[model samples]
Target chain A: MDPKVVNDWRLRGQRYRLEGELCDHCGEAIFPPRDICPKCHEPAKTPQTLSGRGEVYTFSTIYSAPEGFEAYTPYTVALVKLEEGPIVTAQLTDVPPAEVQIGMPVEMVTRRLRTHGEEGTIVYGYKFRPASFWHASTQA
Target chain B: MSSQHLMQPERAVGIIGYGSYIPMYRLSSTEVARVWSGGGRGPIKEKAVAGLDEDTVTIAMEAARNAVARAEIQADALRAIWVGSESPPYAVKPASTLVAEALGATPYLLAADFEFACKAGSEALQAALGLVGSRMGDYAMAIGADTAQGRPGDDLEYTASSGGSAFVVGPADLAVATLLGSLSYATDTPDFWRRAYQHYPRHGGRFTGEPAYFHHTQSAASRLMEELGMDPDDFEFAIFHQPNVKFPSRAARRLGFTAEQIDTGLLSNLIGNTYAGASLTGLSAVLDVAKPGDRILLVSFGSGAGSDAFVWEVTERITSRQDKAPRVTDYIRRRTEIDYALYVRYRGKLKT
Candidate 1:
């Protein structure tokens, strides 16, 4: 694991609260917030905390585990369309890979992403769980 | 009664909100015996298992969020956050700080971690009551959660499970259930223990029965009743720390509580013993069905051993606050069962 990846505590607010920036000119929403709005070509001054509620735009199940995530193989990764007009990529949790659908409603939850190793610092971040809009009972 | 002096507060305090969480995956008792070559006889049918990414911190966060949702107040209004858990993610870092930050309740709040076996949650609850009762804070949050552990083929394996419960304690006017009074009893009876740097706990086997669990629980419950001049018949419902189904039932009978009074809170039958979260979760379940003006008795026992007993009266506000978040039964019903192999993988019990 990269040293920088394990120590991303500097972005705690952005990651934990989904704090993004909004373009004051074109109203463009940017996550991992940038100083410059890509669409308006202007400085994004307004800060926007996302609703943390979204819909699954697309998804894939990883049968082969990644290098740092071997313990959690066969997990679902999804592209979620935030209600605030930005598409964010994240790992889907709580719901199994087989049950993930393109239109599933999801809400963000803080969870452990990966650890460096047995003694390494654990990386924690936001993952999406199926929201109440989608009936958990309906999922067969 | 010496215990009467410790029971109620000058100011009324009660639970403003409460929440509970159970991980989705489950492992059946049959699968446990199959993997370890033990007989199929087990204490309970199945136990909840924390996923690879889930632990005490994550479970606590979920429960706290639900509690805050039901609380209907700004998270920052919480002046303190205390978590009681035997399975904190970090040995040094406080789980309460992480939980507070995740819930956006940081910068100006007291945070700490607590441990006392299964009664850890009640310890935190007691402190929260003090903070709110004495006007130290308008509200405080206390949580009990664990990702319990057990060595292979141990009886603890059949009972150790994962879950969490949280309560927002505040003034009685804003409360769902008013705290009538509480009492605690402790003795240096070593029924179960886990030393620092140890993964799983060791128990004194049958010694846990007569001298540890039974003694403390019976003493605490009996003392609380005697102090308040009340008995089991006074409370509409009663919840006791459920190491297994049998201990609580036996303790209830000894304390003169009938089976019906303990039935709704006996969640250990389905989710196994959640340790710190055991009695708290049972209390949450009881509060879900209890009506206004109903009285409840909640007692939690932790090995070493000790018990904290509280008398609560359900308020008219309970019905309004319950629908704010998912109920305890909702989490229990939304489970996916896993086999022994998957359970081992999820728990990270596989040795390198």
Candidate 2:
């Protein structure tokens, strides 16, 4: 892995925390944020951190993982639509791949992404877990 | 108070809010037993497994978020962040910094990692108490988390599990639980240890008994009780370091605490031993249902042969924050059982 790739990830640490941009003009939420809003085609000027809650828009289970992630073969990857309005793709966690569903409520959680080696750089990122798992039986 | 006394803060400080995270995946002992043997045999029900993307850093981050929510305080209010984990993602780098960054607590704060086998979390809490009580920080976050590992086919494998708990510590006046006092007892007795560069720890088997877990836990609890002039009967609930169901249950009984006193906090039976997270998670469960003014006792044992014990009183403010984060029971109840093959994968036991 390129040291630059890991360094570049450091710049996007805010993404791991759900920090994004809100389009002031068009009232849109943009993630993996950009200086210009894709919707309004203007500067998204306003900064916003998402509520970190969303629903699974779509998902797939990867039986054959990419390099460095083969140990987690048959894992769920989901395209989550945030409550704010951006669709972010992340790995689904906590629950098994078979349990992931469209529209399933989820919440962002920080986790290790991949490690270069025992003595290598380890990448960390965000993943989603079912929000219902937390509140399911505890709600009054 | 005597001038010569145990280490404790003069100004009261305690958990203003707390939270825990247990990975959803579980592997039953029976499944593990089936692999080593032809049939069934093991100590506990099941143990949690961190997914491929999860580690102590991730576990602490989740727990910290929930704790901040329950604390109803901005993450920036935390002046220091201490994470206790034997299985920190990096051996040299501090997991605390990453955790603080992820939680939006950065730029100005103290941060570090602690390692003392299982009681590392309690060790962090002790530091938090000192920081907040001395007014150095209005609030501090102490976390105990781990993705504990055991050698294949080893007894520890049945119980070594993954999970974490976080506590937001602040002045007792605003705390959900008030820490009356706490004490620690430690010695160089090595009942368990993993050398540098070692993958799994080596234990002395039965030697981990009588001398390590039992002696340290019993001594800490007993000494705290004696110092505070309190007894087992005075407390409503008691939590002990649970390396296994048998150890805690027996320790509680030997300490004169009834089964009812320890049952609410007894979780290793379900989630297995969470190492640094074990006792704190147990305490979190007890705090979940404890009524205002209820007294609770917590004693955690780490296998360097040491224990940290504390007596806390539930405050009226607890009710307000109880619902802010998911209860420990919620995590315990929400689990998906997996087979051994998947467990091996989830634990990354496969040779690449």
Q: After superposition, which runs of candidate 2 have C-alpha atoms over 4 Å from their true positions?
A: A5-9, A24-27, A63-66, B1-4
Off by over 4 Å in 1: A1-7, A21-30, A35-48, A132-140, B1-5
Candidate 1, position B245, lDDT: 94
Model 1, TM vs. native? 0.94
lDDT score at residue B230, model 1, on the 0-100 scale: 91
lDDT per residue (tens digit) for residues B70-166 in model 1: 8888888999999998889899989998888788899789999999999999999999999999999989999999999998789899889999999
DockQ of each: 0.48, 0.69
CA displacement after TM-score superposition, residue B106 of candidate 1 (Å): 0.3
Interface root-mean-square deviation of model 2 in angstroms is 1.6
Best DockQ among the predictions, by candidate number:
2
- Measured against the true structure, the TM-scores of the candidates, in listed sequence, are 0.94, 0.95
Between which residue pairs do clashes occur in model 2? none
Model 1 CA lDDT for position B16 = 91
